[model samples]
Target chain A: MALSVQRCWNVGELSSDALRVAVAVSIEMNRDATPVADSIRLVRHSGESELLARQAFDTARRAIIRCGVNGFDLPAEKYGQWREIEMTFDPSNMRIK
Target chain B: MVRFLTLLAALWLMALPVQAQNGPLRITIDEGVIEPLPFAVPDFVAESAAAQQMAQQIARVVAADLTGTGLFREIPQDAFISQITSFNSPVQFADWRAINAQALIAGAVSMEGDGRVSVKFRLYDVFAGQEMGAGLQFDGTEQGWRRIAHKVADAVYSRITGEAPYFDSRVVFVAESGPKGERQKRLAVMDYDGANVQYLTDSRSIVLAPRFSPSGDRILYTSYETGFPRIHVLDVASVGRRVLENQPGTMSFSPRFSPDGQTVIYSLTQGGNTDIYRMPIAGGAPQRLTSAPSIETAPSFSPDGSQIVFESDRSGNQQLYIMPASGGEPRRISFGPGRYGTPVWSPRGDLIAFTKQSKGRFHIGVMRTDGSEERLLTASFLDEGPTWAPNGRVIMFTRETQGAGGQSSLYSVDITGRNLKRVRTETGASDPSWSPLQN
Candidate 1:
């Protein structure tokens, strides 16, 4: 339905040789659409690190969207749904150079 | 009749063998009139007799370099009361001071058996009656004498002015040729004095405003490589590059790195409107920082990263504004009568330099962080993109000449609006950014 993204600055000052990045994407899917694939990637300087931050993010996003669809008895689709997407920092994906 | 014959014979005799004295070389010394520091560079005398021509050539090159800056005037060789006959003897400073010279450049040239030329030059502050600095010697091929002279001049200029010498640095700019409608441009870099040029990119598409990163290892420029104006960062060391990511339905250009080299702040265009955006250097989605309806671009970060100075049209005309790094409402900082753009924060974080367009003319100007003390430094048909010197005392920018036959080149002006001089390039060049001294 709608997506929102936020950024963090001054992360370098916190650590000289390391950087921390987090992204939270909130999306609403159409009623007729089926959840097929989802991914969160943190990239910089031609390198990327991808992973799930917390298990609760996935559960809450799916739960809220499922609850918004078909009035709590939704199959895969019946009405549009709202989902919360979040990712966490992985040091391997971030480098000073 | 006998006395007249005797006088005529005496005159004829006086003119005959006296001609061997190399003709008194009558020379008029120009009077001091708030001109450049007057100095004399006598022809270098070689240690051995076989190196006469090379020695003279070296001194001539050094004299030319010093005079070209318009900051020094040279006394012609004919004005010299005595030719330099020995390099080992002490210099007669009083002789130069008698000619009202403020400074003197004296050197000796030598030739090695291997065909290399060695030159030793000394700069004297004639008024102080002291050698300004230690004498320097350079060894190079016969053809490198010109560069050796330039190096000597650079040293003398640095020692006298207390500013870094730019003569040794090279500038990279967009070289243009051909007609106005079908102009051909290529990325070219040349010596600071306009020599040793090498082209990096050819004009297959439009490229606008190429800027060197602080390290001089890369360049960020706006290019139409993908059939749309986009910002591309090129690695000067490797000639490799990559397109910066832009949000969907938006175009991005005007890229500059943060002082730490961790983020890039640039302008993103969407729906016929433009705003500023910052993204991580490693790679990530860009986050929009300004939501102004009018054009908001040329975002330069303060040296400490506490603030960002950018040009916005929110005031109904392009004006400079300062905003927090976290993105919030921007406060108006420029109240002048012109439209300002290309705001570049000074390296010292005390001033913001910009380009102001007014009355159909563009000018290079600077203002304080709070927008007070606005000073316009240069005005011309086209002058924009003020890049600060490493010490923040000078700014270099592009000056576009107009008319049936017009050209663009780089020029630098002191912060006080003095010392305006044309920066040389192989062809017509523009968009010069000075890099930090190499570590």
Candidate 2:
């Protein structure tokens, strides 16, 4: 799982490995199906204090791990060329980014 | 070539952020659209024939409590992609996700052996495809099903928001009726959502500003029972009450409890002059907190009890002032173009919510303790008496429409200045004081 996730960050690759990884996660969790972010972009809370910034980062990570429960539905045919998913997780507020 | 350069750019990005010094891609979200979290609450399953009617009603009440906040949107039953037939069945996360529901709720009702109603529920995070919290149950008299539902909603709200729940709390307020010139007021207490309203005092005499104690077991209000203004303390659970002190020469009004609930501060009027006075709740000699010729009333204590913020006319116009909990010199905090009154400190202790009147408009607003970052959440013909939810995320206040038919009602607004909603009350309610979370 670590190797697959790590390879997703390799540049210029178009393999749909990201989708396979997400689907594997979904079946492992006993989910019939789910919508996970195609990409997860970890971001920070700008102009906030250090404590607030740290909280923002933690909140973003929580959202990533939480919402990825069922997994993203990327195309299987494109699995071989897929790369890492980047999502915008803005943790300053309650709503999804 | 350009194509090769484009591929190189993509490769550059992929190779980047491997514990890079710059960190993740930087994005500034100063203000983002706040859409309510979508949730689905299927009607509670009836475990027995006696629980059939209550099963659906209880679920409706729970859904209403959450949707009323404008923080959770309920996907109507008609739009359901799948049904929850069995309460104990594992949830189909796919079905809920198809409907774009972030949260799903399932409950069941049964008749308990003790002749009471039993209600239990489980909350699931659909996208997460897992039960977010432990399932819990409540046993209560059948007639009190609404309270039980509120308890369930309170648990769900707390788990999702990571904040204290106000759904199970109560509100003490003044129920007003009749024409503006000949209005009748009564002291009343109701569930926070304005259900099961019980009147404690009739309209025989004018009553105003019913405030709940820290424990929510007692209420302090002013009444003209003896043809003069006097503060009365009432036991909430029982209908019994008594005058705080029968000061023959002075009138007392605008009472508030200290953080400890051991003392109260109110305004005392005598010889056409009004001043703020503090006294022990268990009965004691009154202590004077302010000595001035101007009228000083609506005194509220900071959450920490270290400071008192109240409205005063000492500056020639109505404005807010903060002073030490112990009697001392006062400092003015409001400088905006308006007359401010009824400054209530937030439970979070970070902001002070107040009622402001400016240019023929009244507004509910919040500002930092030191009088900074003032933001008005609502404005109307006559809005006043702002009260904070237990979590300090929302403020409920009185908004009275203009004209001869003007009637006062309760309304709430999130601190974000969005999701302004009118609270349901059986009668015209005013001066609402939200109680602390019940034990």
Among the numbered candidates, top TM-score falls to 2
For candidate 2, give the docking quality class from DockQ. Answer: incorrect
Model 2 bad stretches (over 4 Å): A1-88, A92-97, B1-32
Error of 2 at B385 (Å): 1.0
Q: Over 4 Å off in model 1, which ranges?
A: A1-97, B1-35, B43-70, B83-88, B108-120, B137-150, B246-248, B304-306, B324-329, B348-350, B403-405, B424-426, B437-439
- Total clashing residue pairs per candidate? 4, 21
Highest lDDT model number = 2
lDDT over C-alpha atoms for residue A59 of model 2 = 28
TM-score of chain A of 2: 0.38
Tell me which residue pairs clash in candidate 1.
A1-A28, A44-B282, A44-B283, A45-B282
Return the number of clashes found in candidate 1.
4
* Candidate 1 chain A, poorest ten consecutive residues by summed lDDT: A1-10
Q: For candidate 1, what is the DockQ-based docking class?
A: incorrect
Worst lDDT run of 10 residues, candidate 2 chain A, spans A10-19
